[model samples]
Target: MGLRRLAATGVAVAMGGALVCGCGPLGADGASGSSASADAAARALIAEASLSFRYVGDSHVDETMNQQLEIKNATRGSVAPVLAFTALDKNHQEMPQVAVTTVYGSDRGGLVVPYGTSWDTLRFSGPGEHDVADVRVTVRSAAAARIPAGMHDVKTQALDSQGHEISRFERFSAVRLTNEDDFPVSVRIAYILWDQPPKGTTQQAVEVTSVGGLTEVPAHGTSVVQVSADAAAAVARNSNGPAVSIKAYNSQ
Candidate 1:
């Protein structure tokens, strides 16, 4: 998606009615000052908005390599910024970077919860190493490309060398997904392959990997795209099928 489309979806512009600041008009907050003050105040609130991430440890259980993160809106105003998480190597080198964002019906696009609200279950794939030391999370509000919507209707299949679904194959680590929208959507999916169960409720920490490639799904179109799955998780077998866990916005 382009920047304009993303912006158009995230922040809804009231195109039907032009809200012109008048020469003499009261404010919605009942203030008797300049009419533009309301709009200005709102803009100022988010002008300096920012995002912060809180690491909540990692989990490697239930065939899911869970890296829990808390997305915090530290600013006073509500904002919708795209969150990107980059895994780093021991030497602080950049590795797999996953971006958690989405574009929904008008009023939502990569829209994180409002101010003071935190969203969890933000995920991406890389080295699911519990012992890895470095990781970085960056937030950018201005961008052109956006992942359509949180992936939906994800399925899995075992394929042969010819890409034909078969009873089984050596590759038991794939997930398939299809876009369920009127426009194109981009998504990166993965399956947690090998993992080691940690003590107690802590999920098994494993080496993480995802289906490598960005998939584009056209409006109301269906195509099978394969992703990764853990072969040794005891739960996510090649034949176990594809599954997804996306934290998405649901309009009330």
Candidate 2:
């Protein structure tokens, strides 16, 4: 069936349940059944779309090196997906010619796919019902250090075999400098420092605050907090970079 027709049919089936929700005599059971059917239809619709993109790894910066992009074809049909990575300076200007690599599959190769595949790999078969593509881009010292140092935005786009854009991913990174004395530091200080758990992750709220460190700093001593290197790179690529407010308090 044509893509449009298939999509339309999926939508009709999905909405059929919604339409029957309040008008049917089946009552609660009918509503439940409709909801389930609608959910299944929606998943089918998503699969029919053939491709999805997601960003993985750390969004905060410290000293460790980690960053990744995951591209998946959830549809039963085969699909070829391409990824484009763009790095922006603090002012949001595109960085020219960044070196990027794409790989596929893990050590054991369970159809999970690897990273940095030559064009030949693109022709390989994906998982029966799903496939994943991982892309890793390294920012050399010049690019990493010149990232404009603050809050920055990173944008990624995924394209299909026909060169049609399928999905776009965007994320913000804030880089800041942190010290031990103050546990909950603001994001404006250095644009490269981050607390554990990240900002928007499931455990972010619980991790951003410092829980078991020395509460007080000496009058003339300096305390420190660890920052994620990846987070800093992200902030350097955006217009805002990262901002932090420094305040000094005297503990009696």
Candidate 3:
């Protein structure tokens, strides 16, 4: 299905008033200081919505071959872009398997890209690795993009508080997210797997890969989200200390 169709039914957005910021006096531009700041932030988000993709080769498991597409979101806004992948055989013809699979971001499926400089790895897999000679990925502009809110209010920690396994797959693989607000919220989390601890505000890791997930948290409540087993394992094998980043935002 096209991204538009999936986005229509996939995204569950709560539309409300304009962005809530400081409500002080209006500035020379005839806008409130808070509103001006909000406007600048929004403009940054829209400008940085440009997404770049890098084909990182392919990996195989049994009879399937999985192609990797690394996506980077440079903006501080949440973007849900449509990702389409195709596999072609040596004959330059579409593989016998499904030619196209649409990866659309949604609240339920955890496809939204949250704020800050972030990278996400998307895998496209199909049968018969030998039949697949080439893989191609295409990215579509996000139909809806907005600066995420209440990001700093969301706190996260590894579920493995003790020397025990928190996830069914691995220890400390699941994340516990706490919402301090009085109302319910939708949470988007990105697990940045860094080969080394970051230095200052700069990303100092030699190797980094990110996995993201989304879920709903009740008012003054917390939620436990399980990271992808394969992705977590990959991180465990590569990183000494991985960081769990969380954000909460309301869409209009």
Candidate 4:
């Protein structure tokens, strides 16, 4: 199946549910059925032609909420799905001042998720956001596209994937992207920082911060980018070369 541009139309919901109101005995059963149908629809959508969400972790930085989403593309072609985000409170209601934010994925510009692979990226909400207990992500629509010619034949790596203190109370991670393609490609990258887990626990704590934009990588050459998030500057610089994920789009 090919990807469909979702637009604002919704098909399947990944998280959270709504309260169905009715003054009858069937009301409760109807609400339960509705929730079940939503889950089934979401699974069906993924089985058709969409990516799946693996993990979602969030942390508060200053007044903003940062979420690290691990997304997996299990289709035959690279797909960029339009994602809709809603911050929910403990009651499963939308938080104040945090309206629904929709991120579009197009054949022309947005980052495309490589088929059969999983990667992490960051999303943000708020200037004065309330406590967001959970976030709802829905796949409104998606469109698939082929990987740019040169990019598909290129080998890429992250060099200098380490952080260093640039100033007191400030640090940054500098990464140089080396592209071995014969043509230039536009790239966008993200860095994931993790919080130290509790003593003697195997749980993994993660926080992701995005700090780079579309950069053009010269053919058979390299491009350097610096990333820093004050909320986790020290962790970003001290951690073992934070996991870096870069997506390349056509530079045409």
RMSD of every candidate to native, in Å, equals 14.1, 22.8, 14.5, 15.1
TM-score of each: 0.37, 0.20, 0.38, 0.43
TM-score of 3: 0.38
Give a tens-digit lDDT track for model 2, residues 169-226: 1122211122332122111111212223333321101101111222232223333333
lDDT of 2: 0.24
Residue-level lDDT tens digits of model 1 in 204-236: 223234443555555666445543333234323
Model 1: lDDT to the true structure: 0.37
Which of the two candidates, 2 or 4, achieves a greater TM-score against the reference? Answer: 4
CA lDDT for candidate 3: 0.42
Best by lDDT: 4
lDDT of every predicted structure (CA atoms)? 0.37, 0.24, 0.42, 0.43
Please provide, for model 3 over 141-207, each residue's C-alpha lDDT reduced to its tens digit, 9 standing for 90 to 100.
Answer: 2433432433334666655545343432234556676888676566665443312212211111132
Over 4 Å off, model 2: 1-49, 57-65, 90-92, 105-252
Pairs that clash in candidate 3: none
